[model samples]
Target: TKEHLISVEQGKQYMPTDTTQNSLLNLDLLENSEFSSITRRQFISKWYSFSYWIIFAIIIISYLVYFILSKRSVNPIEIRRRKSTKIAIKRLKNARFCLKNRDFDQFFEEIEKSLWGYFADKFKINSSELSKETIDLYFDKRNIKTETKNNFVSLLNICEFARYSPSKDRNLQMERTLEEAKEIIIEVESDIKKK
Candidate 1:
């Protein structure tokens, strides 16, 4: 009886099955030439669309990486501070050389420039707007002593006067002025640290 039952099942296995009923081996789409062509075109179009989107995504990701890297390398405040300090020191050294060579006009001019450049860099003050009153107001707000503010302003005024007047006594005042200017910068730097 079992042998007969197995033979009947084997016979059913040899019978033809409906093409559309089997999802894995369905051939209806291929049998229709127009439908197969349309499906191939749709697949190609979808491939092109997916490729375009992938390219766009890659571009956006690269830009995001570039933006992050650029931002990571920059620190505006530290850059400004370092550059200003270097320039100020170089100018001061040049002024000292001028003093040693008895170049009064150049020495005064360098000192004035160093002070103005320092203020402009440190406070974002415009060069054209750098005046004694502006310096006084800025230093006063920072809690710098009245005497220190007066001394800085007075030094600037002296530089301006000596630049134009060509006084004979400028040589005598050069060393003292340089020292006072150095002291002013040191005091201001220390005050900034305290803040």
Candidate 2:
């Protein structure tokens, strides 16, 4: 009641420079006191934006983990095929060296070994248990021409016979056998590529 009874002279002198009052006014403006509340649409938009970011982060993290695991994964069949091919190539090189030295016995042995090694690699078969008949049957089953399979078989048989028989012209036999083996390897390589 006394505050309401202030005279015009007293009202004119009511200039209180309180720092606490100024600070409170600044706080009120910072808090947007003029706005009573956020609208429903504004609230939903903010929530959706936050959730979108969270989902995107989860998707990115999941893909990164999947990529890391895929990079480390190895196929067993591919590993075996690579190992066998490497061994086959090495054996072929050894056979060529034996041929160059005119060591008919070693040449025949290496050729036979290399041929079987190539077959084992091409078909992913056990080299130790392989036979000419089995190899021919495999090639036949795969729709390989009879002529090609017979040539490969005959070459293998020649190498075996040359290795055991006491032949006078062993060097000539080695040359023929080496050529035949080379042809078989080339054919097999082409066949494998086709498959």
Candidate 3:
């Protein structure tokens, strides 16, 4: 190749210029060679293997996800209890909205709904069957903290009193009451879970 290049530089136009025999670089071409005879078998083997693994992994992950979700929600009663606080907090948010609008009556109504709905859902009891004594007995049976029960009673008393006699600090009182309502629901749920 060097000799051929030197001859070309010297204007030797008639000289044989076969450079492949002595060229410094090795050339690779796949056209019409052993490498280019690609069969569908090789391609399908790889493609099927990759697709099979991808499908297998998806199935396994889906099964695990389904198992976890189904196991968590298997028991309707347990699901109710676990979601009780979340549901109650949602109701209290509506109460908070009512409070923001200074709708004292609606605020109290929402508070009552939050508490009653929380207990009913948590204990799987009917709302109509929920009285002070019934709640006391439930708490006593579950051995919930006395202070928590007293706080619950205090929240009820505040709601009851506010409905009959109007208070001067109505907005502030309702805010405190809403917070207390949320706390009572959370406390009761935690106590039951603890047991």
The lDDT leader among the candidates is: 3
- Two-way lDDT contest, 1 vs 3, winner: 3
Which residue pairs does candidate 3 place in steric collision?
A: none
Give the Cα-based TM-score of candidate 1 against the true structure.
0.58
Q: Which residue ranges in model 1 land beyond 4 Å of their true spot?
A: 1-78
Which digits, one per residue and each the tens of the lDDT, describe model 3 over residues 76-153? 988987788888899899999999999999889889888878877877887779988877888898989999988987
Q: lDDT for every model?
A: 0.81, 0.76, 0.83
lDDT of 2 at 151: 83
The residue-by-residue lDDT of candidate 2 on 14-114, one tens digit each, is 88799999999987776675443455557788999999999999999999999977755566555566676567667767877887887878888888887
Residues 1-195 of candidate 1: C-alpha lDDT, one tens digit per residue:
355444334564587877668864446647565658778889899999999999999999999999987886697765666577677778899999999999988999999998888777776677789887888888878887777777778888888988888766777789888887788777777776677
Q: Score candidate 1 by lDDT.
A: 0.81
lDDT score of residue 190 within candidate 1: 72
Among all windows of ten consecutive residues in candidate 1, which has the lowest summed lDDT? 1-10
